[model samples]
Target: MKIFSLVIVLIILFILVGVFVKRRSIKIRRIKKEFSVSNEKSIMESIFHKNFLFFEHLNNTFKEKLLTDSYVLSKLINIDGVGIQITDEIKYTIFGLVGLLILGDENPDYFPNLTSVVVYPKMYISDQRGQNKSVNLGESWNFGVVVLSWCDVINGTQNFSDGHNVALHEFAHQLDQQSGQADGIPVNLNNDYYTWKNTFDKEYNNLLREMENAEHDSIDFYGATNKAEFFAVCTETFFEKSAVMKSEHPELYDLLVRYYRIDPMKIFSN
Candidate 1:
């Protein structure tokens, strides 16, 4: 009887060890797959793939820039059950490395972790009273999904020549929410929380004050409504009109550059 009980305990211990080792192996594989960097062959393949035309219209240097590694790209493109309709310049506009590199970069923490994306023909209007023909450009839900209108995507892309892209604006919200909230504060920022809060709050309120008086500004008035909107609108301009934003709102532009950890003016102006 004693021998049988000892054998049973040994079998259970071995089974538990086997399960633990298997689970650990799975976790390591998932991490490695998620963080793999781009390479020559992958870049070439991405360039030739039909879907990659999204990056073709941009300058050659920008074209070669990898928007995201395979892992991140897969995660980003897998937006939750949403339909992605690639059309017109959207394929090119979205493929441009500017927005991806600007809004997403390599940072997995404060970036679009949403697994699914839905694209529309253009500015999709939601017929709510008091709202005219308005296109609901992008919406980042807590459920790890995002929606975008390609028309707005192109418009925002072309307008990059001026200073705005609705796509970037919406995605910035997704990035903010990676920390689990879209309140303009990212989880990985190194600044003192209180300082960031005070600066953003003050600037947000000031923008609201200016918008109420109809003052001319580089950022869209929509940004004045709230902190999240402010982050989104500023991102639109950051990639679209970096020079203008840097010139008009130097402090805001600098802050954005620091937050995103990239300088579009350096990329675009170079």
Candidate 2:
């Protein structure tokens, strides 16, 4: 009996050691990925299979430039390249979404500092803060990476009029952080700071007051959480539910139209 007990103890030790080694290896790989750089490919990215009409209808010059930017942006991101990993598909879809998000920005160097777009298959739970877990559909880290759940991505793409997209929400956070702070203010907005601020601040306050008595909101209630989240939520709504957003909140919609440089209501109003 003593010998059997000794054997069981050894087995448990071996299992624990194996688990530790695996976890350590994963940690090492993630650290390496953080600093790793990748070479850009010359191949042009396309979403022909998805038949996203937004790109299909654009003029050739604008279309080519858009595709190139997205290809370059997606290539810079690192992810799990093995197992049931779907980074390849994620990159392709992200290429499309990124192109759509930056349509208004004239700068060719958009998202210059972003390096990674991490994605999981479903809801990504973040439990890293003080023993509390924060459940997330997507997140954009200030560390040059945007995280997402592919399931949410697909659903968001398919239901493009829902005003909720994990990819857009996270990427909008990236935009907000581009100016070095994630305060719902982007770099270069200083020129139009008063207009943007008044519009955004008023709407944010209105939502706060209204949500106190209501369960549903014309805009995502999450946008009312804070300024940073408000911007991200607005991005999702701007691209996904533009027509509805325009009809309900004309000032906010007009502000988004100017900010994003797109007549989304015209394009998305099918």
Candidate 3:
């Protein structure tokens, strides 16, 4: 009787495993189909042109890829608006920024660990870190979630030259957390880990010194908070103030170009 019970349990387990595999396979196929379909190009292009200044600057090939990537991300990630109506424009705009971040990668995983984005109408109060209440423009949780302020996002999109972008800032934290920790380092360093660490440490210390002396800097002073925050702030400056960063910090600019595999200077040059 015990032998028979064990056999039955094994059979049930096998059946459950098979069912899970089949469902996952079906989901993957649907995602691939959705990604390949280009029926929404006109609508997406309109949204991009209206909201994202960077879109018009991109070449035709880059624009098409960006749209396609944005579409896939829109479909994959669940975006929920709090105290606000979720619209196609909002979805595309948010995902378009994400798409831009990974645009240079040959095989973008599309932030596999990120499942959902929660957007508030504006900055929100949070007590998640215990007793202290804080107002935040955005937050990126290490476990499959990101939160953003819609107003801040819009502001970030409006002025491409400004280094303040909540979406880019928070999403950058998400990238930094991909290595199972929210350190300044991310994965796929391309064998430049030592250089990356040395450069980031040196730059982070420099930012700290600048903050202490109350000196003006192209990079934001907020980056002095920590290595992770510094990376995020650097990402914002890299894309928005590409010309200034390139001219001022060529080594850092070159490092970013290699890591991102795209130069914002090319897009912003025209």
Which has the greatest lDDT? 3
User: Regarding TM-score, does 1 or 2 come out ahead?
Assistant: 2
lDDT of 3 by residue, 1-270 (tens): 999999999999999989966775576558657766756778888989988888888988788778877887887789999899988888889999998898888677678778899999999986565547789999998887999999999999999898888899988888889889889897678688899999999888988998999998889989999999999999999999998988878888899898888999996555
RMSD of 2: 13.6
Ranked by TM-score, the better of candidates 2 and 3 is 3
Native-vs-model 1 lDDT? Answer: 0.61
Tell me the TM-score of each prediction against the true structure.
Answer: 0.67, 0.75, 0.87
Better of 1 and 3 by lDDT: 3
Model 1 residue pairs with clashes = 54-91, 54-92, 54-95, 78-115, 78-116, 79-115, 79-116, 79-117, 80-116, 163-241
Model 3 C-alpha lDDT versus the unseen true structure: 0.86
Those runs of model 1 whose alpha carbons end farther than 4 Å from true positions after fitting are 1-71, 79-112, 125-135
In candidate 3 the C-alpha lDDT for residue 50 amounts to 88
Full candidate order by lDDT, most accurate first: 3, 2, 1
* Regions more than 4 Å wrong, model 2: 1-62, 81-83, 127-131, 268-270
lDDT of 1 at 68: 36
* Candidate 2: Cα lDDT at 95: 63
Best by TM-score: 3
Clashing pairs in 2: none
- In what order do the candidates fall by TM-score, top score first? 3, 2, 1
* Per-residue accuracy of model 1 over 1-270 as CA lDDT, tens digit each: 999999999999999989966775565456445445535335444533444333444455443334433333443354322245553234334434324644434433313355566666655665544547555876666566666776666555444465566666666777677777789886667764676677778778888888889898888888877788888787777777778878988877777777776677665543
Worst 10 residues of 2 by lDDT: 35-44
